[model samples]
Target: MFKKIVMFLYVMNLAFVGNAFAAGQDREDGLPGMPYRTPTDKEFRVCADPENLPYSNQKGEGFENKIAEVLAKDLGKELTYEFWLDRQGYLRNTINAQRCDVIIGMGSDVDTLRTSKPYYRSGYVFVYRKSSNYNIKDWNSEDLRKGIIGIVGESPPTIPLRDNDLMANARPYRLQRDLNLPPGHMIDDLVAGKIDVAIIWGPLGGYYAKKAKEPLVVVPLPEFKSERNSFDTLKGKAEFNISLAVRKKDKDRMEMIQGALDRNQSKILKILDDYGIPHVPVVLSDKIGN
Candidate 1:
């Protein structure tokens, strides 16, 4: 469900091509020979996905869209977007390619971009019908073994699911799909009783659960340390801090964004609450690495 989230952090890093600029430049926009164009004072150019929701879409209805509006308003600039699909080559085609000045939301640990201070933190969650009365809060629950589970293939939760021997009864959904397609199908199946439970990213699960006709339960998984010598793909970290991103050379733009985020923090949080997004406190001491 959060293929966009995972791909943005891990896959996009491969698109970066190392660049060097001369030292002691007087410009705040770009140094003498920088590749990308700096953002102008008149417009806040944003790189965004046109169809992913709970995050972004063309209609400007997602929480990221709302947050972008807040930032742009605070910065005294008109908001504009370079719409792209959040898939492989996304960074190569958009921000890194110089199509936009900022990405409204990205994982804070992504090495390919200069990310701002995190605005919010979120993680994967368990979604099931409230009628089922399943009080599952962790991966060790016996109920998970008995029920048919739905999960996005290759996501962080899969590591624990496999370790618990629950893969035999689990159904996997595609992580990457066509650009025009939107998410929330797994939660749709859960509400229709096609699956007993859905283990998905928190924002996706929470938004869909709030929209479901039948009441659904959303439980956040507790943080756990990855075992030493473990070969799990995600290293057992389910939560992550999300931040705005700029080109590696755009430190000025990053600092400007950070100021806007600090000034409008409450408005941004209100937008997340209005969208039914589930979030956790961003604890710097417990920060996860790339």
Candidate 2:
């Protein structure tokens, strides 16, 4: 049922992003600079997760928040957030529905919205307690079958789990586990020995592993033979090249963001590195047509 809901949300997100036009001139949806002329609004309103650290938080500490500040300064706007948890209809409820104007980190593959050129690319990773001496890197590892693995439920990482029949013994992290709690709570579980291993999204896993109270092993998943890279393959529905998304009809807004992003690419990457995100170099030519 969770999977079905997520799939539905994915489809709806694409629809909302691709169309790009304002819903209705008669309907006011809680934002400015749409359905009319150039936006002179002084605020650069963003939609983000309040507790999803390493990505975003209300205090403006996440890498995305730093990047947003950079962009705001570049564009001469003030940064503001519409905080939402990463839950069902996140895209539909916030930016897509026009309750907010922008999202800093979204995959570029969604054809629904006009996404900025990807700023960076990353993949999933395997995180385990170093004290356990577990060094499994691939799903094909025999040790994986014997271990009590942790995975965020209904996420791309679960695909390899299902393919290998590892769900029965898995310690599944509910997608909406703790709204008030910080994101990537699984790493703490690993530290406490509540779980033997965790397959986590790269940014969260890499960041938390470095921040763990005790040493934890973090390994980027190897590319499956059938797939090109572990990150791209498992998250097959999308690429890891994260970008800012805007309503499609808002081409002017999109261009403004794209330019700002390009101008500050170096600073943005440094922020990501500080968060310990494992990613590939961005090919600007590919993200933006040369």
Candidate 3:
């Protein structure tokens, strides 16, 4: 898939990852849960990617997990999850399958499932080892014209890479690969001096940029400083709104979940800060029909 962000966000329906729930619960049709309803018990059920760090993981170490914690505590509900490996068919298998009632870090724009008001927004970014002293601020910078650029192969970022004529030195990586394998393929290469900068999804880029063996610098593409829609030309490369997702027709639950998000926002923001998530808020274009 050339548009890897599509795979990461929409397809991230989730992977075979996360804490396991007991399989003995009774179901009307031998499924995980019923579709289109909130839990009757005191649980906030989440559909999660088991291995996506800085987001959700089995150990509950990721920021999304922290957000879930804030949510459960605020709503006076216990936290639980329906784990699914992030891959194609994830949506059909988890939330859509009614295995869980919510997806904690989904893009607000995902049309398959109903999404809450955006809790946060972020975009793709350029990450390079600071020791390399790369000073690129935008895709058109002359500083970027001379180095190896990394990206999820064939993604929307490639559109700008081509437009800016930076594809000559570009490197590509897979969007879907072995789950248990080592992570951070692009930033890993950047840190190893294999590439000058890696254009990656903002959250993972910011998290890994800080952890690179050498100090690393992260520059938000199009910079969330400008209009959040700066990359609209490339169709969703630069920024996107993130929120919780519930099955279609789940408006009642959506409002309840959105209320939790709206109330405990500060606590949720603190959790994102603790994980080094690059938080960007979305700005709408009511005039342009966004």
Which number leads on lDDT?
1
- Higher-scoring candidate on TM-score, 1 or 2: 1
State the weakest 10-residue window (summed lDDT) of model 2.
Answer: 1-10
Misplaced by over 4 Å in model 2 are 1-39, 96-99, 225-239, 282-290
Compute the lDDT for candidate 2. 0.67
lDDT of 1: 0.73
Clashing pairs in 1: none
Give lDDT tens digits, candidate 1, residues 1-290: 12246422222321211011111111234323446556677999998888888788999988889999999999999999988766655665567667688888766766656777788888888999998888787988888876789986666667677777789989987655534445788898998899999988788889989988999999987655456425454465678787787887888888888999989988988888898888888868543322
Instruction: Go through the candidates in order and give each one's C-alpha lDDT.
Output: 0.73, 0.67, 0.66
Assess every candidate by TM-score: 0.84, 0.76, 0.81
> Which portions of model 3 miss their true places by more than 4 Å?
1-4, 7-39, 223-236, 286-290
> Which of the two candidates, 2 or 3, achieves a greater lDDT against the reference?
2
| Root-mean-square deviation of every model | 6.1, 6.1, 6.7
